[model samples]
Target: MAGPVTAAVLVIGDEILSGRTKDRNIGYIAEYLTAIGVDVREVRVVPDIEEEIVAAVNALRVRYSYVFTTGGIGPTHDDITADSVAKAFGVAIDVDPRARAMLLEYIKPEDLNEARLRMARIPAGAELVPNPVSRAPGFWIGNVIVMAGVPTIMQAMLDQVAPKLQTGVRMLSETVRADAREGDVGGPLGAIAQVNPEVSIGSYPFMADDGRPNTNLVVRGRDPAKVAAAVAQVRAMVEGLRKPG
Candidate 1:
């Protein structure tokens, strides 16, 4: 059987680090990858510095099956993820014919200024991750996948890249609504989690619509049977806690 396929997300933008742009890409990428049997294990937000982007990409690309970076691929001056990624791989970069053609599809030949031409520059031997929303394409070199920062464009690029990625057994999760606080479930849940070594048990505390304290006991695992068993344990515990003393 194939082992778990894992990935890391490298969010590249000065706005993100400065708290100017509320990042919407990480959550979307994580959930999207999870549904497709790819586990996103690490997420790092970095400034728009070329060195930082290169360092983060190198670090994550080696540690995970894939490293996805969103941001810094635009036409503006701060869009340096492409160059930094190329630097990391020690590869030459230039305006690729394919990316340039894609840009021409959206922009008139007469209007393809130098600023817009910057979007077509790709690292040597990188495969373009198509952008359906906008013609500007992202690129994938080895295990590192570069994408746009814009949520809509990034999602479109991911759609093009997903078919090429390796997938593993999809993680299955079951949630048990525990009408109790985390404190009530922590101990028993901890014990249950310790016994079920392969399953992940998490307790999320929230308020109900009626304003009552509620906890959600989520059991996640690759095997449905194991998840079901863990959920059964949680349900039994919740039922036991509700019974009058």
Candidate 2:
């Protein structure tokens, strides 16, 4: 695909990997990125360990056009995303002046203690990502964009970051239904996909009126005309198969 802006999501936190918290960030970010024409290529969930975070950050940042990390940047003891990311790039971690000033605007001095100042600590040479609801900001180092784990905070941060990103062609999808089973449609769908390589064809089976299984054919692609053409071809093939036999 031309001008494809691929991204990877790094979900850092022991709560997520251990199943203590169900991750809602990945789906939200994926939908948001898709809407803006950025394709989410991969997602990795890492624990609160520094080594894991650093490794994931290093790996994803190099592979994708953008790497977005959520969680572990909080004010808690387990919040090590910033330090780990800094270590990944061999940069010093310190309280950024701008971030500190921003935090000071909202939080009291007592609130900005050691535990809280940890939120202000950012990797050197990184640009700050503004958090509108909360003053504590996320930071971007190289291709990696680190944001909060909380759904609301992450959404706010994304709103600020989305406008700055380079986006690709938005993907469009269409669906067609058939009385045929998934197995019956799979072969034809695969053939159609091969013929229209640009379009992605997916066959989903569901219970029909007679308690028999039927298939739903979904076609998605960057080009609307290509997707439509593929869907029409698949529909015609299914209709022809349903004739008098």
**Highest lDDT scorer:** 1
TM-score of 1: 0.98
Compute the lDDT of residue 17 as modeled in candidate 1: 86
Can you give the TM-score per candidate against the true fold?
Answer: 0.98, 0.92
State residue 111's C-alpha deviation in candidate 1, in Å: 1.0
Clash pairs, candidate 2, are none
Q: Which runs in model 2 stand beyond 4 Å of their true positions?
A: 206-214, 241-244
Give each model's whole-structure lDDT: 0.93, 0.90
Error of 2 at 103 (Å): 1.6
Writing each residue's lDDT as its tens digit, candidate 1 over 1-245 gives 29999999999988998898999999999999999999999999999888888888889989999999999999999999999999999999999999999999999999999999999999999999989887999999999999999999999999999988999999998899999988988999999999899999999999999998899999999988888888898899999999999
CA deviation > 4 Å runs, candidate 1:
none
Stretch of 10 with least lDDT, candidate 2: 183-192
Q: Positional deviation of 165 in candidate 2, in angstroms?
A: 0.3
